[model samples]
Structure formats: structure tokens, C-alpha cells
Target: MATLKEFEDALREHGMNMALALLERLRERDRATRTVKPARRLTGQKMTPELARAILDLHATTGMTQQEIAFKVGVNQGRVNEVIKRGKWLTDDPQAPEAVARDKAKARLRGEPKPKKAAVKEKKVAPRRTNQGQLALGDL
Candidate 1:
């Protein structure tokens, strides 16, 4: 199937100026009628108590799904689920699991070195014996 651009090129090849002008006018009309919505936030907003409460209220009051709530609140759907199900981000406590995770993420984004855990010695395993040396019935 030929696209509009291809059709336009064909029309131009045939010197169909009137059709090309019509196509351009149609494109202008489409551009004029098209409504442009503000782009949704690509990065999630910082979760706060108020935002958590708002998420909860939206969940309780409306039939919005976790994804819809996340879109509305500019947060991850997982974050919305945490807020609704586990009551996460309801406080400003730095010790909270979500807060701690967020802090760790920010630290990672800033190129901070991760804390190393104590190294454990690996257990050595013996290699398995192959059947390459075994004589088969055909060989015998």
C-alpha cells in the first residue's frame, strides 16, 4: 500500500500540483484540529504523605486502576500499589523501607559506591567425568 508521502511523490512525478496542494491543505487542517495534551512525566514524582493520601483517596473513591492512579499522581504503578496496599510513604521517616530504597537509588544515580558485604569463601566442586573414554557396544 502506498503511503500519503509516496502518493504525493507519485503525484509530483506526474505534475499533479492541484492534488499536492489539496493534500497540504488537508495536512494543515489536521494540524489545526489536533489537540495536543501536555506530556506525562517520564520520571516519577517524589512520594510524600500528602501524595500517598491522595493516591489512597483516588483508589477508594474512584474505580481507577493502579496504573491510572500512577499516571494521575505521576508515580510508578508499583509505588501506587505500595501506597494503597502496604501504606508506604505515609510518613516522612527516613528509616522507612521505601524512603531508604529511594535514598539508595538516588545515591546510585549520583555514582556513589555501593556498600560491600562480607565476602564468603566459595565451595570448590569436583568436575564430572565424561563418557568419552567409555567403550560403546558398537566400538566393542
Candidate 2:
């Protein structure tokens, strides 16, 4: 393993191309060991199939604007556009165990089924309720 100072010295002497490749490999290794977050809560709101249907139904029946949906739902108009235009993330990557665990927690809260592996995990990492009777994820 080359010290960063040594690598920088090499970069200064030999030029960036080779040293940069080695630096990138080091960064990749660092990233591999790091506990990366699975999902980013974007400016876009999360819309379940139910929420998607609700938005569509409202628009189809009432001819509401993006601003109207945003106001009614209490999200940004951009979020409404993302939901109505781009889409939501439902079928997420299965390899993400953390995401799977979160989904299991959410499903249990919603009185829904979990997969076999998720059901097994439910007994272990399931959240506790507060004195206020909150499930801890809070309202969307």
C-alpha cells in the first residue's frame, strides 16, 4: 500500500493519469468498506401504488393542477411532477438488506405480509412504540 504523500509525489513527478487510477482504486476500496446509505430522500415524494392511484384519480376526476396536488398532499409541486411524470421507486434492489429490513418494518406497521427472510428479521430489529403511541417513522 502506497502512502498518499508518496502517491501525490508520484503524481507530481510522473503525471496524473497513472497516479489518478491508483487513487481511484483506493477510493473504491474505501467505499466498499463504508456503510453506504441505500436510498436518498429526494425532493421527490415517495408514492406507493395506493398514493399513485389516489393522485391519478384526483387528476382524472377533478382536473387538478400540480400545485393543487402539492397543496392537498403537503409536498412540493416538483415532487408531484416527479410522481405524475417520472415515477416512484417501488421494486427496489433486492440485494440491499437494509432496504429490505425497512420495508419489512413498514409492512408490519401497515398490516401487510413480509417475505420469509424478512419475517424472520421482524422478531429481531422491529421498532418499539413511544409513550405517545408513535411507531417512530412518523407521518409521511
Indicate which candidate wins on lDDT.
1
TM-score per prediction, in order, is: 0.60, 0.31
* Per-candidate local distance difference test: 0.92, 0.67
- Assess candidate 1 and give its lDDT: 0.92
- The all-Cα superposition gives candidate 2 an RMSD in Å to the true structure of 23.1
Task: Please report how far candidate 2 places residue 100 from its true position, in Å.
Answer: 11
Position 4, candidate 1: lDDT: 78
The candidate that wins on TM-score is: 1
Alpha-carbon shift of residue 99 in model 1 (angstroms): 2.0
Candidate 1 residue runs with Cα over 4 Å from true position: 28-36, 40-43, 57-77, 121-140
Model 1 clashing-pair count: 0
TM-score of 2: 0.31
Count of backbone clashes, every candidate in sequence: 0, 0
